[model samples]
Target chain A: MAKVLMKGNEAIGAAAIQAGCKYFFGYPITPQNELPEYMSKELPKNDGVFVQAESEVAAINMVYGAAGCGVRVMTSSSSPGIALKQEGITYIAGAELPCVIVNIVRGGPGLGGIQPAQSDYFQSTRGGGNGDYKLLVLAPANLQEMVDMVQEAFDMADYYRNPVMVVGDGMIGQMMEPIEFRTPVKRELPSKEGWATTGTKGNRKPHIINSLFLDPQGLEDHNIRLQKKYKTMKENEARYEAYNMENAEIVLAAYGTTSRICKNAIDKLKEEGINIGLIRPQTLWPFPEKAFQEIPETVKAALTVEMSEGQMIDDVRLALNGKIPTEFYGRSGGMIPTPDAIIDKIKEMLGGLK
Target chain B: MLNDKRIRIIVGHYGSGKTEFAVNYAMKLIEQESNVALADLDVVNVYFRSREKAKMMTEKGIKVISSAIGHDANLDLPAISAGIFAPLQDETCQTILDVGGDATGARVLAQFKQIINFMGYDMFLVVNANREETQTKEGVLRHIEEIERQTGFKITGLINNTHLLRETTLEEVLKGQALVKSVSDETNIPIKYISAIEKVAQTIPSDVDGEIMPIKMYMREEWM
Candidate 1:
């Protein structure tokens, strides 16, 4: 297929349909509204269903119901909208349902502003809802990666029988970029026949989908089982890109739109004879801690940059584990850190190390 | 040079570079016309609106009118400024109305249909063949019909402003020109301008239907 320029939100909608997602339920929100709008228009043409529910809460529950039917189902929203969907998301996670949830993050503890920000790192990675559960979170830095990850998110959700979240900032959702849909490698997915709540005739037993467990022991066992799944994901699914790691004086840790900015800064620093590397995590939940080990011995310090006031820095600290002196630089309230600002931060951190 | 119409309303598919073209057109018009006003009538898209460049345009003496709230207001509320009426009413000002993208975006123009039609404004549908919705001649026609239906106004001109951001090439521009040219022939809507980045604009042959409008990418950041 020829490459076509697509807005990130519309590309995600197209990717979901191409991935055989037959059901979509979402509400309108800035930055990510285009996804649902695109789905509402195109899904029906492909013999699928698109529902604009009354609210994000209602939309996520609709996703829960659709996923229980063993169909590829998804819902998307921005920050506050995603927060509204938390209860439903936890239910979907606890029920071990396969669905894709996308959060095109904007700033806020509460309706911060419609511009891009990476503030939802904790909400997505650390479980916003009540549970001993984990969502397989994929954070894509650009549109092409976002498209690829969104399609793959459906497969990973089904294979593991858990919800997978593809998180990007508002910039990623709003920007236009050239992208081509490629066929993803098929996974050895478990058949949904045995577990799904598809109506059974007299020939088979009826399947139930529920997150509630009255018995304490039953809930404990369920929690343990979910933890085991998360452990497997951590071992197998953690992904990151280690750019210019061959020999480096400083390393930058960032993701999503911030990572792209970091790459530009790294290139500029290289021109000035300053060797800096970057560790961009593609998967945020299975936090890609393993990539930190690849940091060169010449590295003087590690700096974590974000569009928020350092939420992902916690994960970076845990991943590095005192291997190197870790520092943080960030901008919040919908402010994006420019390449020059990032370079200055790197230089400042290097100077401090001296 | 653009059309002689006093009011030029720019409409197109989302990300078809309408805002970029509108900004460039206003700047170009300011060189000849003393009173130039750039009204951002876009209520659909929150980001990348021409109003975001209000300060710079204001510094350059172009009257920048955006959301009803204010020029610096970053809220996504669908409130357009009533101040737009002044420029439309002003006989001397060359007003560029940068409408939002798609039929949804073009619907805003309907609110001004009476004044626009009465004043004899020129509405141009900017076409980018690289955009998924406007990739084919049929798609472009569908877009035009929808916009015309929404606004109850006929498209008088076509602006081929196709691009893939900074990665735009001469071949890409030519491909877009071919698509828009076919649409022009069928619709009889004259090709008003073939807008491209300065580098690609220089490479386009004179045989192309529209006068080449070499534009600077003011809307996008350097790294974008």
Candidate 2:
């Protein structure tokens, strides 16, 4: 297919449909509204269903219901809206159903602003919902990567029978970029007939989709099973990109929109004879510890940059595990970290190292 | 140069570079016309609105009107300002209404239909062939009809402002021109401007139908 210019939100919507997503349930929210709007228009033409549910809470529950029946389903919203869907998300996670959730994050705590922010790093990677669950969280840095990730998210969700959240800030949702919908890598998906709530013939027993295990032992067993799936995800699905890691004095760790800014800063720093490397995590959940392992011995420090007040830094710290001196620079409430600001922070980190 | 129409209403598919074109068109008009006002009546999109550039345009002496609350506020409320009436009433000030994308966005113009029709405005449908919805001639015509039906206004001109953001090339512009040219021929709506960035605009052949408007991207960031 020919490449076409698209806003990030619409491109994700198109990607979902192309990935054979037949059901969409979402409520309107800025920065991510275009996804629902695009789906509302195009889904029906492809013999799919698009529902503008009454609220974010209702939307996620609808996704749970659809996923229970073994169909590719998705729901999208901004930060505050995603917060409202938390209870349902936890329910879906507990049920071990497959679905895709998109959080085009905006600044928050309480509807902070409609601009882009990486403040939801904790909400996304740490599982905003309840009890012993993990979402396969994919954080894409650009529109093209985002489009590819959305399709892959659906497969990962089904392959593991778990929810996969594709989180990008408002900048990724609103910006325009040229993208092509390439074929996603095929996953060896298990048959849904084994567990789906599809009606059974008289010969077989009925399949029940439920997260409730009233007995403590049953709940513990369920939690144990879920943890094993999450562990497999951590081992097999961790993804990251190492840029300019050849020889570096300082390494910058960032993801999503902030990672793109770091790349720009690294390029500018190179022109000044300052070598700066970057480790950009494509999957936020697993944290891609392998990328940090590749950090050259010459690197003196690591600076984690973000659009929030240092949420992702903790993950970076955990990934590095005291291997290097790590520092942080961030701006919260819709303020983006520019390349110049990143450069200054890198230089400041170098000065402190001296 | 734009036509002598005092009110130039810019409408098109979402992500068709309408906001970018409107900002550039306002700046170009300010060079010739002393009083130029650009009203961002786009209610559909939250980000990338022309109002985001209000401060810069205001400093350049172009009157910028957006939401009633404020231009700087990143609120997505669909509140059109009463201030939009100022330039519409004052014929001396050339007004450009940067309407939101598609038929849904064109519905906002229906509210001002009486004054707009009475004053006689030129509604230009900006076309970007790269946008999936309006990539084909049939798709462009369908949008034209839907927008016309929604606004109860005839689209008098077509602006080929197709681009792939900073990666736009002369070949892309020519491809869009061919698509828009076919639409223009069928609809009999004159192709008013073939808008492109300076580099691509200079390379366009003179045989193209519309005046080549070299636009400096205002709504997009330098790094974007």
Candidate 3:
């Protein structure tokens, strides 16, 4: 219950330990490198496994190996590194393994740059690696959310029997902000005796965890079955945050760092008598499209701002359709606009509306 | 008014040759026996930037103000100072603040704006296309407006320093000029100068009688 100035990476590492995630395998990368180091020290003290794999691919498979045994496990890396792990992530999804993967995303398109960017919104939600699969991806805006959701990710992974990911970028990884750690939820981890690949417990059948269903129809059925779970997630788990939305004439839609900036813009614009609000998505996978749909008719426009050229903006425009004129403001690759800069756009657009 | 030591806010998009602009600007000013300095204020970008050129700036006596060498490449990079704020107020000839790619990165400028304005300093925001964020006129205007808001300072004009590092083509400069013209018409701010990585400063079109920055300090010292 103490307020500590911890980076988002360190907070997630601590939360993982609290959540009884006894295994972590990750490759070292910038912004989030503190994570592996923190876990290296924290996990072993709690009698956990912290394996530093040679590559991102190796790390996620290590996660697969650990999750197959029904012990809590996780892995993390940045954007380019995550691309390398997608193959193993696909396997983790296909096998219906419960694990947590953290992506402290950096800019990209191929080792683009090491700045905070939400360019991975599409990659995390729309399946970056392969197959018709959905990874329960959570976007935490602050250090507190980073810790809360890392713990929540474990619970969600177990509840749904699927993989979960914490998709953030450099801002979340490196920024030092105040955080309050969650009381480690002590739950009896699900029983592994039935199918977990642990040694035979009292003459039980030999257990195996593999995604090799050779029959095409059988694979189709499995994928369709997975689709049902995704449907459930989409229906029940979409979450977002709104500020001063009741009296606003326009809405600023953003996620991650831009979303936080949008909050500042909304407050300053509101002070100047321009009614504005913010919609910040917490779950990027089960994206809170319904939240926008619930906006009142008094609200006319939504401006989608992101660090990418237009990844999340496209999603916003799709969510609103023609109900309102959705506009977009973006600074792609590795650019971040000042708070005043975003407010200026809202001011310009508000004048246009007038 | 020839105080080169005042803070020169050199703003630009990523990969738009802002680092090189700071380099040549410092080099030219240094050779002129001006007490010049530079500060790497670009936080939201990593690699192939002005930080890579830190050693060279020091060799030429260009004091580069920055926080924690090899620190996080981010927007909130701590505002570092070498006590140059005092000297630049009256004595020094030029001091350049090589700010980050877009508005947020330039928001760091807000921290120092009031002081600089009070001390009679000038600011120039750099524009480039080959960069992802500032590829359009609208994007450029948004960035310009954002920087102005954050720093409480206005960019008098634009510098179309559009180049692809070593592989910059002449055509990109021409297209960049066209983009600058659109911005000029909309905001009424003249296109100050369009610099090339090769240090080529061509004749300004009739409407633009902007000053030329005829220096490009890369691997050598020969003028093309």
Q: What is the TM-score of each candidate against the true structure?
A: 0.98, 0.97, 0.64
lDDT of 2 at B130: 96
Model 3 per-residue lDDT tens digits across residues A114-212: 777888888888887789888998998877888988998898888777899998877778654556677645545565566678888578778889888
Cα-lDDT of candidate 3: 0.76
lDDT score of residue A256 within candidate 2: 92
- Summarize candidate 1's per-residue lDDT along A7-122 as a digit string, tens digits: 99999999999899989999998889999999999999999999999988899999999999999999999999999999999999999999999999998989888999999999
Model 1 per-residue lDDT tens digits across residues B163-213: 887788998999998999899899999999998999989999999898899
- TM-score of model number 2: 0.97
Local accuracy of candidate 2 as per-residue lDDT tens digits, B1-224: 54549999999998998999999998888989899999999998888899989988998899999999899778878998999999999978899999999999989998898999999989999999999989999999999999999999999999998888778899999999999999988989999999998988999999989899998988766556
In model 1, the clashing pairs are: none
Worst 10 residues of 2 chain B by lDDT: B215-224
The C-alpha lDDT values of all candidates are 0.91, 0.91, 0.76
Query: lDDT tens string, model 3, B8-110?
Result: 7788554456667777777777877657767777666443356556688778887766655442334334545545365456454577778876666787777
Model 3: what is its DockQ?
0.04
Which segments of candidate 2 are over 4 A away from where they belong?
none
Native contacts kept, each candidate: 0.68, 0.68, 0.05
